[model samples]
Target: MRGLGRVLDRREEIEEIIESEHKRVLPKLAEYREKLKGKTAYITAGAAHGHAIIALLKELGIEVQGAAIFHHDPVYDNGDINSDVLSSTVKNYGDVKHYNVCNKQAYELVNILNRLKPDILIARHGGMVIWGAKLGIPTFLMEDEQFGFGYQGILNYAEKVLETFDNIEFTLNLAKHSTMPYTDLILGSSWESSLAKEIKADLLILSVPITYRLVLTCGYVGYNGGLRVAEDIYDRVLDTYR
Candidate 1:
């Protein structure tokens, strides 16, 4: 069957990627492990993305202080019970703090961050960065879920964490003087008519916007997408600090 052939081909491709990425990423992670020694992190993202990043960080010797998933699904469409994100994460990483909350709950997230007080915060959605900024914790904003897909993805994640820590002073300075509203800003909405007027955060339009902006080419789904997202975030951080 053509479908079966395509599935087999995909499996082979993924196998090759994993093998190649392991060779490429392991040495880099060894270096990163030393640079990240004793640092703790808290992650807040969607189920799959959060799980992958947590796994990669654990491998790199970063302490995962806690994690918050936006939602949880007991089983996925494939009908495999073992594929559940929550169970798999716990099984793999062991008893790190976990929370299930929606993306809009800024108050609760802030409370949790205050309680955990991790050295860094890693997040994937809009508005989450501001809480870490407000709390004076350096935050790395993952543009999408594919950020931890392959070995390069793992390297990219490590690089971003190091960059976040490298620029901690800037984040602390911003927090000291930031007057941005404590509530979540509704991107591409009339509520936040002018994002510049509301906050000084970098804006990257990644989704179907309700505003006049149109996205025809840029995507964040696969291998190339992961690279693009990493580049965009890194460039933004450089632009901010330099």
Candidate 2:
């Protein structure tokens, strides 16, 4: 019982740190609100920040027409984001369509974008960004520089690896002994190469330990809050184009 209690306490502490870092990036969203007015935009974001950013954009007078929300999970299910709040939030924006971008086919997204005909696209993950670019739409990406316990969505890979191996000790043993690179081992060769293509991320939000440091490297600007900053950057692009 004592050991369980200790583990729970540590988990709470980590959650607190993540939550705090998430809030810290929110202020930057305010900087570009006004610049977003009048543009019709589509956004892809996770539950936590995605819903909030949508509300903020509405307040700023931007016409957000479609969104693919990666819902904040209620339970730990490797990469499966719950769309509970996200669906409702999109409805609040009056006819704004919401899509579940979690593990869905790319063509579905392309079809949605074609129907929405947004002036710009804002996304929180690599896949959406690539889809947006393929359609010749100006794309903006906003995502934490890393995710899920201070890694590049590593938990997702860990979960998939666990599924593949089907045993805890064996999974760990394979990870320890496998000659394959960790990224390749976890994400597989197909995803590895595709992830490489997604590397030219547009707007990266610094997360955890160095949450406040904003760096704009790789031709992609870095900001504090995840998708909120992406929305801001997308708004500015809208301002320039329209």
Candidate 3:
């Protein structure tokens, strides 16, 4: 049957894709393991940027000792992440430092972090970030994902807040580009399919009273795109205490 043949083809394609990504991640994993061999790393999960950072760090074989996962949650039923998904996809080591609030395990994670006194804290999600601030430790807040329309209002607020925080990071969007000649200025990031945001595309930011702007970002894709910026700030956060 045509449907059957199509299904088989799709399956093979998926396998090929997985194989490619695995190859890409493997060497990077080795590199990370070498650098972060013994350091304690804490990470969060709530969105793609956070997810990628945590996953990549763990994939690189970092010594992720303690974690506080704010799983923005594709994992609904199982208190634990599902087996089908990549363990690194959600957080370092599948949120190995995951704390279940029902069991008051979240408290345990905080207590453990307090005693262990980790060198770096990489956090995502709003509430956990607030908590990280209180810790007075080196912390990196993962900026959230924003679709084109969603970015306007957010950017308006962020323009003010970004003034205060040293690092306001977001995952590069994985969306197709829009080609309309006009755009708005009140927003931020947008979404697409396939891989991620490419510099070639122009984004329109919209506002209420005809104040529109186009965001033309160059050299955008993968962790390297946004991550390079984060790493700089991460270094600064570390230096502040050290």
Candidate 4:
């Protein structure tokens, strides 16, 4: 597990990456309706990921009630639920939800969660774990690169010169997040396990970004790639906390 110090050391760089981040979370789009239909979630913090998730949920049939955005400005697309942007440094998405909590503190965040009590809470930031735990909501932790990759990279180079890139795609990878079950993260990556012994949730949704990355990069092959990733995540989470 990477420590707080390690994570902090790369904080600025990570923030940049996460701010520019693009993660592929397609869950076998065919079953998307089945997986997300009738389900609801609260996407807190980080607009890009939140927007991505909002799209994902909508595709899957789940309703994205709203987001507790932590970027530059609150983007308002829906008339009802508003988004929260913490500071100017954090970037917001174009789909723009509403805005409200501008200068408020913990009360605003928890107050919103207390009101929503969403079925699932998806947070992409690697730093803030206490807030998620405090919300006492079933959380999904998204890790950037904790999972293993390289099952298909040919790394072909002529005279160390970069040649055309051809990545081998996996139809599915059942072992994507095998170690998650042993950790404390909801999406149980090492991110949430700093003082893991101090806090353990009844359930965790630990996700692996590596396998799914390949899936999306592979396009049509992503359908199978995503489902297999989910299966792997689900099985590991079940084994650890279920």
Candidate 5:
């Protein structure tokens, strides 16, 4: 009985923490939602994070223009058919247009972006950001897989997004000078292999796998993470003059 009592107490403590955090974060999120509402975004990530990001974006009143999952899992470990990532995402966030690509096929992604022309692109991997840059889309590179969980997580996300939007000019300038090396046919005989230029893209690295910049202990796990993402995106879009 004592052990059971302890377990119950711990559970209650956790609940209290959660409730406290919720109260603290919701008002800020509401503020962000007002600022971010109606904005369109295209998301590209792996299975689980893709769904999470979609949900997070919806919470901020952002419209998902489209989403592409790197892979799809037909079955989850829980053995619940309805709980699969794709089904759950649709169920929770409405019927968002989504694609399930097994690999990072740049051409396919580019085609989708061309058709959608979303206001922004959010991708999990660094490589994917280049395509968005080439197409003059503000891109957010989400590196920290674990950063979107709690109250702090969401807030961080919102801040980061706002920052990204605030710096749109840099991205545009980079895009103007950058080129997408697509196919041999596209390159043709005029393409010189020896000719290279120092060109960069306006890519906001949100977390780990930092290439140019260094980031430590950043993530997109909870409420704070969601907010951080929102901020970065807001900033990026605003900067883009979009």
Candidate 6:
């Protein structure tokens, strides 16, 4: 587990990067805040990052009508839910609905939204974003790279690359019938490597479960590419807290 000082240090790095690269995102966030005035909002956040956004909304005077906070399952080992990390930030906001990320379901989300009847839905996950859109509710996604392309994503990509290589080797071996005597050994090695890679990939995914804390606030500070505009905004707005 990382210490709070480390977390705050990471937050500082994110703040610096936002200060340098994504200067416009903060202004855009402010603009959105202004636009959201008088509109009631329903927010669902995974990990501490979600609470930060809620804090920001409250600071900007937006009416946060309801909030759903999802913590990753304890067995997943992403990290223990440290309520203390966000408690101070969200104190006056009132009781926040809590759920486990593993238990999240589209139907349950919709049912909650239907009950809340907020003017807009703000969430950190893409599925929730899509759900909001489908229900004719305005949705805003607060995200960083960890949402899709973080540790788990890297493992997924590596697995695909290895699989592709194994497929190419298997095809080559099949094409050379004249060398059938040697094919058994080559094919066996290829198959074994492929199996090993698949197993390793699966294990990585299981151990490094795609939990909310994997890419919480300030996680985007060091990345240099992809979703430039959105990443810029996410990192910048998030950096203000530091």
Worst 10 residues of 4 by lDDT: 156-165
lDDT winner: 1
For residues 53-120, write the lDDT of model 5, one tens digit per residue. 88878877888878888777657646777557767767777978655556468888988887888878
TM-score of 1: 0.63
lDDT of 2 by residue, 34-144 (tens): 444466777787765666556544644567786776655633434444534455555675555554546345766777876777766767777667665555555656575
Model 5, position 140, has a per-residue lDDT of 91
Ranking by lDDT: 1, 5, 2, 6, 3, 4
List residue ranges in candidate 6 displaced over 4 A.
1-35, 72-83, 92-103, 145-242
**In candidate 3, what are the lDDT values of residues 138-241, reduced to their tens digit?**
55555543321121332332232223234423211211222222212212334321111233322322222323324356333587856744553344334433
- Candidate 6 collision pairs: none
Q: What do the candidate models score in CA lDDT, each in turn?
A: 0.73, 0.52, 0.44, 0.44, 0.72, 0.50
Query: Which residue pairs collide in model 2, if any?
Result: 25-224, 25-225
Instruction: Using TM-score as the measure, name the better of candidate 3 and candidate 5.
Output: 5
lDDT of 1: 0.73
Q: Top TM-score: which candidate number?
A: 5
Candidates 4 and 5 compared: the better one by lDDT is 5
Ranking by TM-score: 5, 1, 6, 2, 3, 4
TM-scores of the models, in the given order?
0.63, 0.38, 0.38, 0.36, 0.67, 0.40
Model 4, position 132: C-alpha lDDT score: 40
Q: Write the per-residue lDDT of candidate 4 for residues 59-135, one digit (tens) a residue.
A: 44556666765653345544323443223212432342433323125556566665776666566565443344554
Candidates 1 and 4 compared: the better one by TM-score is: 1
